[model samples]
Target: MKYQDQLKRTLEFENTPTRIVSLVPSQTELLVDLGLESLIVGVTKFCIHPASLRKNKTVVGGTKQVHFDKIKNLNPDIILCNKEENTKEMILELEKIAPVHLSDIYNLDDALKLIDLYGKLFSVEKKSEALVSSLENKYKDFRHYIKDQEKLKVAYFIWKNPWMVAANTTFIDAMLRLNSFDNYFGNLERYPEVDLNTIKEDLDVILLSSEPYPFKSADIKELRSRFLRTKVVLVDGEFFSWYGSRLDYAFAYFKTLHQDLSD
Candidate 1:
């Protein structure tokens, strides 16, 4: 079968891939969902979605650093990666070993496209269609639920130390807009370092994600002290940031979050 990857390179695979190495954690989980687990030979340490797989699979390395020797030992027929998650230098290095399929995702549409692509790659069309249909229904319901509500001006913080925020070009920002929340920092290009003092006091809400920097309950209190008028909410980072199967739960979580803010 001839297949073209996100990079627009076409290749032929005579049979189903027997040995696959996934570098991106989210893509790893998506591959497992597509029922390509038996074919997966290596995964990064961060690929901890299906906890059972974590215990059994060989850990290649983290997102930025990979054990090339370990990867060579696996002798994978195919490798999956992401443009944003994995560095270009690393992708170039991996391409030297095997055909690397890289994905670039920035919105929910891209997420669905990836799922469809994986489905075609793995010959799991039924499963992929089912998942996509479910997600579509959830998204539609959420959109309808929020159509009548007032859009809240929100600031979604992803990191600390430098104080970075999700900008308009990101998947998180798309998700926020879909949920009827206006991103205060959407004008910025990417995740930019934001100054709290510069943020308007009239901002409706401030959301602290639970990953990357892992914002905790105490962090919310601290933020609240500075932005007393804004509702500081702790959000599951996976639901907002992870562009994999976790998106299935994001709509429900958003519904509850919207309700919480309404109260």
Candidate 2:
């Protein structure tokens, strides 16, 4: 069978892939949720969602730095990756070992498409369809809930030190828009670095993500004092950024975040 990935790469498989290696954490969790657990022989160290898989599955290393030897020993029939998470050089290298399926997600629709593609690739179409339907229903409900609410101008910070943020062309920005948050940095292109002093005044809310930096309550306090005009809050990065099965609960989480802020 021949399949085309989101990156337009051609993946040729003899049959449904039995030995699977997932390099992206979110996609690894999606494969498990799709009931392909036994087939996933290896995963990156960051694929820690199911928890049990971390103990059982062979660790192939992190998103950007994969141990090719470990993956080679697993003998994966299909290796899953994401363009944003894994490097192109690594994808080219993994191609030598097995068929690589690369996913490129920008918005909610693209995420759903990736889920649908995985279902066909793994022969779990029924499960995938149900999951997609459920996600769509939840999103519809969320859209209705936020229909009358004011769109809060938000600045979502993903990293510190150099101070980077989720720009217009990223999945995080798309999720923000879906949840009725107006991204203040939407005009910017990719994940761009900026000075905190320049952006503190333009936002209604300053969201600090839990991953890639692990922003906490203490960090929020410091920022809140400095950026007094903006409401500083800590958000679960997975809900906003993990474009996979995690989305099933993302809308609910977004609702809770709004309720808490209103209180």
Candidate 3:
């Protein structure tokens, strides 16, 4: 059978792959949600949804790096990747071992397309269908709930040290728009480092993401002291950036975020 990935790459498999190596954390969680946990032979260190998953699966490495020999020994029937999560160089090396299915998701539609394709690829159409349906319904309800919300100007901080924000052309930015938050740095492409002092726009909220940098409460307190008018809060990075079965909860999380801001 043949399957086309989000990157327009085609992968042919003799049959549904039983031994899979998942390079992307969100996709790995999706596979587990699809009842393919037993089939996954290797996963990344970041795949922490099940929390106990790594105890059983081989730790292949991180998003940017991997242990080629460990993956080779597992002999994955197929390897899964994502354009934003995995590098092109990594994909090339992984291809030497087995067929690689790469996903490129920017918005909710793209995420759903991935889930639907996964169903066809693994012969789990019903499971994927139900999951997609659940997410769509939650998204619809959330949209309705936020229809009356005032669009707030937001600066969502993803990385600290040098200071970086998710701008245009990222899943995190898409999620921000879905929540009706106008990204202060939406003009730029990809994650860009910025000096918050340079931004003249009056931001109603300054969001600190809890990942990649692990922003602590002290950071929020420091920012709150600097910008007394703006609301500073730490948000779960997974819900905003992760595009998979994890999306089933993003809608609810977004709604709560909006409610908290209102309060």
RMSD after CA superposition, every candidate: 1.2, 0.9, 0.9
Worst 10-residue stretch by lDDT in candidate 1? 3-12
Residues 173-236 of candidate 3 have per-residue lDDT tens digits of 9999998889988999999999978865388999999988899999999889888889999999
The candidate maximizing lDDT is: 3
- What lDDT score belongs to each candidate, Candidate 1 first? 0.88, 0.92, 0.92
Q: What TM-score do all the candidates reach, one by one?
A: 0.96, 0.98, 0.98
Tell me the tens digit of each residue's lDDT in model 2 across 115-134: 99999999999999999999
Over the stretch 152-247, how does candidate 1's per-residue lDDT look in tens digits?
899999999889999978889988888888899989977999888899887999999887898888899899898889999998888888898888
Task: Give the C-alpha miss distance for residue 2 in model 1, angstroms.
Answer: 2.2
Q: Supply the global lDDT for candidate 3.
A: 0.92
Error of 2 at 202 (Å): 3.9
Off by over 4 Å in 2: none
